[model samples]
Target: MMLTRRTITRGPFFWLSVSSGIVIMAFILLPLIQLFVAPSVEMLRVSIQDKDVAHSIWLSIYTAALAALISFFFGTPLAYLLARHDFKGKRIVEGIIDLPIAIPHPVVGIAILGVAGKNHVFGQLLAELGIRVMGSVTGIVTVLTFVALPFYLDAAKAGFEAVSPRLEKVSRSLGASMFSTFFRITFPLAWRSMLVGLIMSSARAIGEFGAVVIVAYHPMIAPVLIYERFEAYGLKYSQPVAVWLVLISLILFFLLRILTLRKTVEQ
Candidate 1:
């Protein structure tokens, strides 16, 4: 009798849970659907043909890819160290790495400007060397990197942690050097997570506007361009560009998802 009563109550709870999930999914997807449908097909086509829009899209992709590459090269070592070591102040170090995530993105842009603006020390030095950061592609990449670092770093750290130390130890015991063991064993096992991190970092960088706009507004990325169009013209002009950006993002995201899933199944 108790079991029968419990089963009857469980049905209601299960339906309630499913209803809540459906509501949340609709809430999240509705905006995206509107973005796609609100713009006419003709407007989307014309927006994509605009030279400035095309250039901004290309610039966003290029700079974001460069930022992700830089993060992958430098952050991976740190992630490995954080995962494997028990050093003093490790928590503090990790906190510092994650601090950017907690800070307002515009503040990050301002902070970066203070350190890397034309009159600042590093900025002055770089200017002397003829490398402009403020109002240049370099600045865009710099701001993107600053804001996107934590995502990739945390993902990589988690990936490395997921790898079994025992496998690395075995590789080392077989006369493999540490570097060889990591590349041959640890990295391979952990690469899928790292790739996911890279995709997320690149996506975040591409979508970043607050920081990038503050740093370099001339060679505009897509987000900055969308804002400029909205403020200068109106939603009629901006919506089309926004729709393009969303379509591009969604396409890339799904491609990466498919690739990641395939790799996971193979492994």
Candidate 2:
């Protein structure tokens, strides 16, 4: 009986799964591990003190955070609409939302350029308002928002879906307005998921490179700096900045995992 149980517990499929998992995990971790250790302690310290590098990192974080914030305010209602309603073009709308992920990053920048061209009518209007897209902080935020919005919307939609509609109905039955009930019932339960979405969107924004590079390279977000350094001075110069980005990314990853784990437990 013991022998039979051991074979069942450690079947070929189990062994194969573990082997494949190990291989994939190692493949992903190898580069990150190598990067983290590439720069000497002294190099990292000096890089930290570099004002330009510090500013680049801060710009990346600030722009990403702003994009996520924009998603929250503008996206919440749309997310709720998608989650609760069965419209004729709902699937199409969702697909449209996912298009940013499917589109190439470089192409995203190009498309933004076309829209923001000084010759285009909309571009002229923006120009008239003194909002320049190329080589400006506004351009960077716009690109980040474009890339990050989908992540926030998807998460928020899922969050609203998980919430029971019966609660909303109850709130309404209690003589509460739809607006009042949302704040009282739906938002409270859904806020956690929305927060998780916010973090995800922010992380996505922070990592954007190709689009932001084309739109606002002068502002030099961390990824842009990494590319600039790598192009100008090779990996030796780039790796330290990369290390800092990796650290920030790791923090976001951990925080995301914690929120996800807690949400799972609560559910």
- Against the reference, the lDDT scores of all candidates come to 0.88, 0.93
Single out the weakest 10-residue window by summed lDDT for candidate 1: 1-10
Write candidate 1's Cα lDDT for 1-267 as tens digits.
Answer: 123445456678877887898899999999889888898888888999999999999999989989888999999999999999999999999999989888898888899989887668887898789987778999999999987888889989998998889999999999999999999999888888898888888888889988888889989899999999999999889999888888777876986798678877876
Where is model 2 more than 4 Å wrong at Cα? 1-9
C-alpha displacement of 178 in model 1, angstroms?
A: 1.0
Off by over 4 Å in 1: 1-16, 259-267
Whole-model lDDT, candidate 2?
A: 0.93
Each prediction's RMSD over C-alphas, in Å, is 3.8, 2.8
Candidate 1, pairs of clashing residues: none
Q: Backbone clash tally for model 2?
A: 0
State how far residue 209 of model 2 sits from its true place (Å). Answer: 0.7
State the weakest 10-residue window (summed lDDT) of model 2: 1-10
